[model samples]
Each structure stands twice: as C-alpha cells, then as structure tokens.
Target chain A: MENSVDTLLPTLDDGIKCSAITSTDGLVLAHTGSGATLDEDFLGAMGAALFAFGSKSIANLVGGKMKDIVVEGEQGFVKVTILNDKLLMVTVAEPLKLES
Target chain B: MQQATTSISAVQIAHNIEKRRLFIEKPQSQAHVTNMKDAPIYKTRPAVLQRAQNQDRTPLLKGEPVKEVKIILAGNVGSGKSTAIRAISEIPVIGSDAKAIERNALHNKESTTVSIEYGMAYLDNSNLHIYSTPGQRRFDFMADVLCKGAHGMVVMIDNGCRDPLNEMDYYLHQHGRFLQNYPGIIAITHFDDNNTDTSLLDYSTYLLKHGLACPVVSLDARNTLEIKQVLMNLLLQIGDFKTGKKRA
Candidate 1:
C-alpha cells in the first residue's frame, strides 16, 4: 500500500508540484514529482523534529493537539498535515490558488 | 707513589675542603631568583588583580544594543499559517474562533478572518512580533499592507492537499516581487497524512529555481522547538544581512 501510494504521487497532476509521505519521525516514506534534489532521509528526520516542536509549543500554551501547519513564501508554499500516529503528508505548490 | 702523595700537600687538601664547605653552606644569590616568598605576598593583593580583570572585561559592554525583530507571517488559507504564527508567539494571539460570516448577496456565511491577529515573543532577549493576516483572496491587499515593513517572512504550505504548490505560486505572484530583496524561510507543514514522493529539499530546489535566496525548512506549525529553530535560523539570516549591509 505504501509503495502504491508512492507511485500514485508522481502521477498526481503537475499542479500538485511536489508531494511526500513522511513518518512521524520525519522519514520520507515516499515522494513524487520533480525539479530539484531532495534528501528524503534528512527531510524525514527534520519533519519529525518539526512535529515535535510544533506539538510541544501548542501543548505548552494549553492549546491542545496540533491539527495542521502551513508556511508560505515567495517561491512557493508548504503544507503539513497530521494524518495518523505514524504518517504525515507534505505538499508543495505554486503560490497561486493555495488558499482555494 | 709516595712522592706523588706529597704533591697534594696538607695545605692544598685543607684549601679544597674549605672551598667545598663554603660552596655548600652559602645561600644562593637573589639576583636570578623568582622570589618564591614574594609570590604568596603578591597573591594577597586581590583588589589589584580584580581591578585588572575588570579592565580586561569592560570593553565588551560598549556596543549597539539589540534591536527587536519584526516577523510577518503571510500565506494562503488552510495552510496552517495562523497556527504556525500562534505556535511561536509569546503573548496571547487575538484571532477568530472558527465563526462564519456572510460575504455577499448569496448570504453564504464563511469562516473568514475578520481582523488581523497579532502576537509577540522573545528570542534570546531579542523581541519578535508576529502577525497573521487573513488567508482569503479578498485580503490580499491587506496582507500586502501588513507585510510592508516586515524584517522577515515565514511562508507556510499545506502538504495534505492536492495542489499545494499553487500556494507558493500565489505568494510569489502577490508578494514575491517585493520580497525579492527580503530574507525569508519556507516551512512545509502537515506531514502526517498524504503520501507523496516529493521531498523538502526538492521543494527547496523548486524555490531556488524560482530565484529565492533563503533556507527551506520542513516545519510542523504545532511544534514549539521546531518553530524556535526556524526563528533562530531567520534571526541568524537577519544578522547576516546586517553584517552584509555594514560591509557594503
């Protein structure tokens, strides 16, 4: 199922730009799409680190669990969603139509 | 042999013995000495050493003081952008609580952002003020207005959605031109759901291809330490810019 998800990722219309299945540990289980070399292992680790930081911040503030996190910049946008205990999905897209 | 023994006569033997005794008994001269007894005496002068130490350390306190950093968070809706801002803000953030408002004649109430949310936090004694603008398209003008004088920007994206990259393109379209000279950080959020092959480095490469000169960090807006690290990196970037400006 995981491998199949990985394959389907590259096929998700080019508008999707880039996609990755990262573990709670920030490990990149799979990725699709292109343009630029991405280090899956490092991103995976960093992803976990990001999750821990975000969750801890919210917890410290008594805001409860983190539902999702997003970041936008000139070049593009990055969205992080907590899918389950073991997985997170990260998506990158053009700045246009991101809110939609 | 007996005649040879006479060569070292009683007088000469007595002279040698006397010379040895004098060499052994006489104290060493003080000219080349380090004055071991005076060493402890000098140690007793703690006040002088304290003053010398203070003189050596006093110069560091005389420089330009730290300036507060202003951070502006700009992004599209559902990018978890607001949550990202809330994560690092030290003060209470004023934001909407998922309420719907009517937009037009259709009477279609939407959970739109009514007012801007602002918060502040301190990063290692340096103040950081963060603002979250409405993510709706209608608020683009407002977003641009709020983003006008920011020292840095944190661009967020949602990874679970189908067309996440469009958010990046939209940001570039609306704010990229102005931010061309600004230092920014790209944060990829929502890593727990969608399964894709793209990596953060790949996303970073895409940004660089679009002519952005900054670091791309994979971040979960809910994590505090991760957010702090990102902020730290941004602060370092600001420091670098100041240094470059001073040099120029």
Candidate 2:
C-alpha cells in the first residue's frame, strides 16, 4: 500500500506536490511527499471531507455517484478520486500554467 | 490570462453554491431548487446568506430582515447532534451523513456527519433554522462555518462515551468565546437511567470550574418532546442574554 502511494508521485508530472490514500472518513492510510511543509493528517481529513460532501451532493441531487472532484484554488489544486467504496485517492498539484 | 482565471474562479464559486442549493432544497433531497416554486426564501435571498456567512447575529436580536432564528448544534462524534435535529425539525432534514470509514474501533456508529446538516422548525411565528455541525474533530471548520450568525448553540455530549466530562470540556473550550456572548446549553444524551456514575451536578460543577454558565440537562435525542424541551431552554437562554439577565 505504501509502495502504491509512493509510486504515484513519480508517475505524475513535476507539478504534483503530494498524494495520499485516505479512508472514506478521512484517515490517512498511505501518504508520500512534502512531509516537511504539508501536514498529512490535515490533508487526509480535508480530502475525505471534500469527497464525502461531493459524493453526497451528487447522490442526493442528481441521483448518481461522484467519480472525482477537482478544486482549483489560487495557489494550487486539490484532486480527489474514489478508489473504492471505503477509500479515496487525494492528490495536490500546483496550478497548471497555460503555454503562451 | 488574469481575466480567464477570475472567470474560472467565479464559475467554481457558482458550482459550490449550486451544490449548497441542492442540499438545502426544501423537498426530499432534490438538487435543483431553482425550478421549485415554493423554494425557501433564505435560499433565494443571497444577501441574507452573506450576512449569515459573515457571522452577523445582530439581526436575530433586532428582529429585522433575517426572519429565521439560527442555532448551531455541535459535539463529538456519535453524540446524537444529527438525531436531535431530525427529531425536532418540521421539515425534512438536509443531511450529509456518510459512512464512517475511520475510527470504527472507537465509535459504534457506522455513519458520521461529514458536512453540516440543516433543518427548520416553525415555532413562535418564526423559522428556527437548526444547523448541526459534523461531530468529527477534523470537520471543525464546518462547525465554525455554521456558527456564523447563530442566535444560540447547544453542545450535545453523549453520556455513554468513554469520558463524557472531558468531552464536554473540549467542546465548551472550543466554543467558549462564542458561548460567552450567545446562549450555550449542554444536553447530556444517551443517558442510562440506571447508570448513576455521572450525575447532572457533576456537569454543572465542571462548567463552574471552567467559569461557564451554560445550563446542563439530561436528554434522549430520539425523543422529539425531549429535543423540543432542550430547544425551548436554548430559546429562553437567548431571551435572557438579550435582556442582560443571563445567569452568572
């Protein structure tokens, strides 16, 4: 499980800052990258929370399951994906600069 | 490029609001309230939401534009905060109760509130908007958001938890500043009548040590009347606070 989370960092581009496998209730199962700056526990918690809120909104409003949610903020972007019924894969990446 | 970024930000904000509207829709979990003819007035009025989001509780005291009385229910996981809202709310409660995938060993409940749960009850010719915060410690931000413009707050502590008194202390300290101005009530739920290990007086003494004057009561969250009585006490506290007659 740790290897799976660790390998994801290398596969992605340099823009990727951190990644983690979190439980549906926001517990960090596996994590890698930028441990010095980013708090993995806080990241896992917020990721689970964001996914739960998105999934619930989709289930209640449109009557379907949420595949993923990408939130683009000023500094970076947070991407959350449903890995299974009970787990989620959350990735934090820097803002994608458009090629001029 | 800056213009493009700004536009995208606006779109993202709209997307978030759309989700909020869908969740808060009066009918049974419908996503779009825009088409509903009898949509809630609070949902329609953006200004009211702005004020509430800004943590403006003055309107409730003045009895002006904000027609609803906002109250926040906050506590630890599995403390029956959501159940209390469901019991007392007249409308179908808007809930985001999701599977509790973590801390299973600690808590017996399978689901936990990940986001805020909203419910409304019409009482005393006014709408009492009850917002219950997600009980998990990580979702404390949701609780703070719901605390915006709240007339009163109720901290529901589960008597059956491993350390109920410590739990009460944590929640009270978390919202201590807010409780100092607004009314705060502590209702001990899941009380086993036969279990006399912890008494109501114990809670009162605990509060006194913390220099908090919030009222403490034992309650069964599933009982609608009992929940209503707790809410009534909160209302009375609100009244007392407004008149400068709050308990010492």
Best-fitting candidate, measured by lDDT?
A: 2
**TM-score of chain A by itself in each prediction:** 0.74, 0.86
Leading candidate by TM-score: 2
lDDT of each: 0.58, 0.70
DockQ of 1: 0.04
Candidate 2 error regions (>4 Å): A5-13, A34-36, B1-67, B193-196, B243-248
Residue-wise C-alpha lDDT for candidate 1, range B166-192, written one tens digit per residue: 666677657665555566766767666
- For each candidate, the DockQ is 0.04, 0.45
Instruction: Score chain B of each candidate by TM-score.
Output: 0.65, 0.69
- Candidate 1 at B225: error in angstroms? 0.8
Query: What DockQ results for candidate 2?
Result: 0.45
